[model samples]
Target: MKEHLKHDLEQINHLLDIIKKQGVEYLKLIGARPTSVNHIPLWETQNLPESGYGTEETLKIFNQRFEPIMVGSSGPRYLGFVTGGTTPASVAGDWLTSIYDQNTQSTIGQGDISANIELETIHLILELLGLPDSFLGGFVTGATMSNFTCLGVARQWVGKEQGKDIAKEGISGLIKILTATPHSSSIKSLSLLGLGSNNIVKVKTAEGEREAICIRDLEDQMIKLNGEPFILISSGGTVNTVDFDDFMEIKKLKEQYNFWWHIDAAFGGFAACSETHSHLVKGWEYADSITVDCHKWLNVPYESAVFLIKEQYKILQVETFQNSNAPYLGDPLENFGYLNFLPENSRRLKALPAWFSLMAYGREGYKNIINQNISLANQFGQLLERSNDFKLLAPVRLNTVCFTLKDSEKQDEVGRFLETLNDTGKVFMTPTFYNGHSGIRAAFVNWMTGENDIQLIFETMNEVITQLK
Candidate 1:
């Protein structure tokens, strides 16, 4: 068994060598290919067949099955779904994390691996966003779980004020939710938490372009309610055009209506790093809780999300899971069950990569990366505006650019053309429907992306559009 484990470890090391040497080259060739010869077949086999154990078969499988998918995310033009390319340091840190393989549930179990990294990363994040150090931060799976944790705490606090014990007893009555053009994830979170999506009051936006939750409509709805504790959801970044909702107005409503304010800043929260874009998210400091993903703007690996709670003990009050008398598992000096703060029992030390990246790059490094993307996005928008064959669909805010193809009859046709660009291995971009019209969307969040990449995408887009013409 020891021999076999050592052999497997060597094979993994060999694979990493291949990744280091050929990863970037392979990405340039087929990274954003729509339907290139760069994908592995998916199967549903449950068991493996016994065969002659040899290095040849192992190498073949490694090359054929894993290499394609591995290079998919390392490309310069992968702009679908707000995915971020991993930095070399963070990737190496991930390898170390797997090698150590510690279960970071509590300080006692992991011996400072869990507590120290979490504390350092959270402090760095708070300082980066210019928030108070008193905030409580938890590293969760992704944005969805982050939202679940944040909303869960809000539910507990509001229920407690109304003389109900939500932690002891689950939500039993009808709870109303108010949202300003919620991302589908927020609505799905409400559903998962037993709050029906139908019960949510969708506030109207001012212009059809930006989805700002109308303060007047929200005020009217609150007055009609029968004093039921509500959850008011506001977005820092709209998924379609990256528009920010008026947070100052939303904050006023939070005070007047006395409801919990939850800001879903999954992709756009990191823009606060720049002074120029900071005003876009004004009044975010007043939020009850905020959700930010390190994978997006922070350029870290996947599954690094932070849910910041303004009131630290609120997490302990709402999410205390186990309270047993196991002597071995209990520690009097430190909270042995820090996992109770999140939904998971055995958590990953996911904060290590973020902490390492922040430590390596510092604040100025982060500011430069974010500001570069913002400027490059605007430059891309300008490139589109200069073209007669393309039309700029929405204002370039933060890092997203929305535009449409000219001479297209329907929005679906434009969407089909964009998919063709992806299929041809030229570039990878996604389609989004804005104001009921289909359009192409490009989000620039990868640290490796630069003006050259943006220009290449624009050139490829023009080529695709000309082919359609």
Candidate 2:
């Protein structure tokens, strides 16, 4: 045995205690940590030693090399890119996930029940979102992968409509996809699936400063398809202003059309927890597939999201992702393994963090998180509204505020303003372009964010603008 390995095993408890203490200190000081930092020079890579260093020494080296530049992307004032902070319960589950290191590939006859736990966690998520049992869901790394999985199945279903198996035989001819203001991740998914992103028929958004789909334009595009089967990718909440497509109208169209409907709910799906905002997603339950991100509004750790597809399309999903040649893995239909349902052959117990979070904070608890974040967002938006130096690009639709310089002629200054604001290390926001004008977007998804944080951000923004002037 390696000397370092033996030493690590013997002192595992002490090693873990050190890690626990480090984690506690980081979490305790997260709010005060810098949200952005200037680039630090990388540590020179070293050749492998003849004998490995002991675990404690190795950790010390890592801390010295990398810990200083670790930014506070998960902290309260990180209002950038719809980032969410980890909950205490989620951190607990994440730690256990690494310790156990279980491969969550099957629910039965696999000598592990972690997959069963994942299935139950999916059920709990559906219940929380007020979705019907008709939908079956599985966890993936993030919204991008979730979108890929759903659209992969959609591609197969489109092929099936023409009596072809695209998964086995490869993409055949043009597969039409229609969307208005789809996220970049969805376009990336199309490219990954061999469905050309340029092939998407860009539907028109609603009039004025809206990002929502224009129902009339969508209907016109459907007519142009001339009865050919297609896929419609809709947004539950857009990233910048959190604009939601009219799901009720889309549901009506689904009854008359033969196209598959998919919704990229991502962070916005949490609106179901708000009685005041729940109406925004009234008919999303009817979607053929839905993507939701646990790392965003759910306040779980990074790389956690779920893709929910209708139970009726289980066979299609299997066709899209089944490991057909592996006889030892058993029949996908009869035995029922998640390995045959989604992407990736080997997966961690990715559902654990989400399960712990949902269990620790029930429906009411999530409701509070969602509502509180929304309130904070509106509070920030109100500040932007009253500020003489800034102007809102759109109303606070959900949990994001899109604003820009009060003078449209100073549009070129948006990036500079954002850079200065982010450099403050007091708050972080991302630059955006909206309605032909450059803008800055502050998304409120972190659970620790409150009125105090908003006020701090507001004051900081004013100070930065004054400096810029």
Candidate 3:
């Protein structure tokens, strides 16, 4: 076993050397391939001949089978779902985390390594988002779990005032959630929490507007409610174009209606770092709870997300998973339970990479990187406007640009052209639907992306459009 472990370590070290040498070039080569084909079977079986294979042979088979399934998120042009490429520091830290393989359920179990890293990461992330440090923060799996944790606490807070203990006795009465333009993930969270997504009352907004959820319509919805405690879910950034719902107006409605206000800032929360774009998410500080995914805009590796709440004790109220009579598990002074506030008991040490990234690049460094992405997005938007064949589909609010082809029949044609460009390994862009129309979408969330990358994307787009014409 020891000899096998040593060989595996050597292989990993060799792969790291190859990664450093090839850098972005190798990533571009891999990213230019089709991720999935329609005819490809979703499932395949590998038969074993009654005996287990040796370590090296097993490892080779594992890489051959699973490596192609991985997406090229590290590539500069991967703009599929507002996902960001991981930073160098964060990726290295992720390697270290895998090597250590420490479970971070309790402080005592891991000698406070997990707890201290989480705490430090929370402070750094809060500072980056311009949020108050007094709030309680916990590292969750991703934005979905973060939203679940925040909304769960919100449910508990409002449910307690109505003579019910939701944490112990689950939500019994009809709990209605209200949202102004709900992301699919938010709706999924609501459904998972037993608060049906269909039970949510939608607020109407203006025409040709990316920002849905009118404050007046929301107020009207609240007034009609029959004194049942309601939760108002506001959006910091819309999934379509990074459009921010008027949070200031939403906060006012929260005060008037007395509903728990929760902000879903999964993709755009990091925009708080930039002076120019921070106002887009104004009034975020007034939220009862906020969800941020460090893996998204912060450019950290996947599985690094956080949920922050204004009232620290509210988390403890909803998530104190402790029992008194455990023989070996209960230490009064140092005993920490895993399933406290988060839903999961045995949680991974996902915050290590985030903590390492923050330490390597301080607050100023983070702010600069975020601002650079915003600038790149603006440049891309300008280039789109300059093209006669392309039309801006939405306002480039932060780091996302949505544009469509001028010739309606050539919409899908343009998409195919973009795909061809990707196949040629020049740059990467994706397709998204805006206002019921197909268009190209580009999200600039990679730190390695710059003016040259933006120019390459636009050049490729121009070439593709011309060829289609």
Cα TM-score per model: 0.89, 0.97, 0.86
Q: Compared with the true structure, what per-residue lDDT tens digits does model 1 show for residues 355-400?
A: 8788888899889988998998899899988997777788898898
Candidate 3 Cα errors over 4 Å, as ranges: 1-44, 48-59, 62-71, 108-113, 206-208, 313-338, 409-425
- In candidate 2, which residue pairs get closer than 3 Å at backbone N, Cα or C atoms, i.e. clash? none
Best by TM-score: 2
Q: If the candidates were sorted by their TM-score against the true structure, best first, what order would they fall in? A: 2, 1, 3
Query: In model 1, where do residues sit more than 4 Å from their true spots?
Result: 1-3, 6-47, 51-59, 69-71, 108-113, 312-337
Clashes of 3: 1
lDDT tens digits by residue: candidate 2, 1-469 = 3878888899999999999999999999999999998666667888887777888988898898888989999999998889999999999999999999988977778487688889899999999999998998898999999999999999999999989989888987999999999999999999999999988999999998799999999999999999899999999999888999999999999998889999999999999999999999999999999999999999999999999999888888988898774423434546768888998988889999999999999999999999999998888888878889999999999999999999878888889989999998999889898988999899999889888888888889889899988
lDDT of 3 at 50: 53
Error of 3 at 242 (Å): 1.0
Worst 10 residues of 2 by lDDT: 325-334
Q: Cα lDDT of model 3 overall?
A: 0.74
Q: What TM-score quantifies how close candidate 1 is to the native fold?
A: 0.89
For model 2, state the Cα shift of residue 253 in Å.
Answer: 0.8
**How many Å off is the CA of 405 in candidate 1?**
2.2
lDDT of each: 0.75, 0.91, 0.74
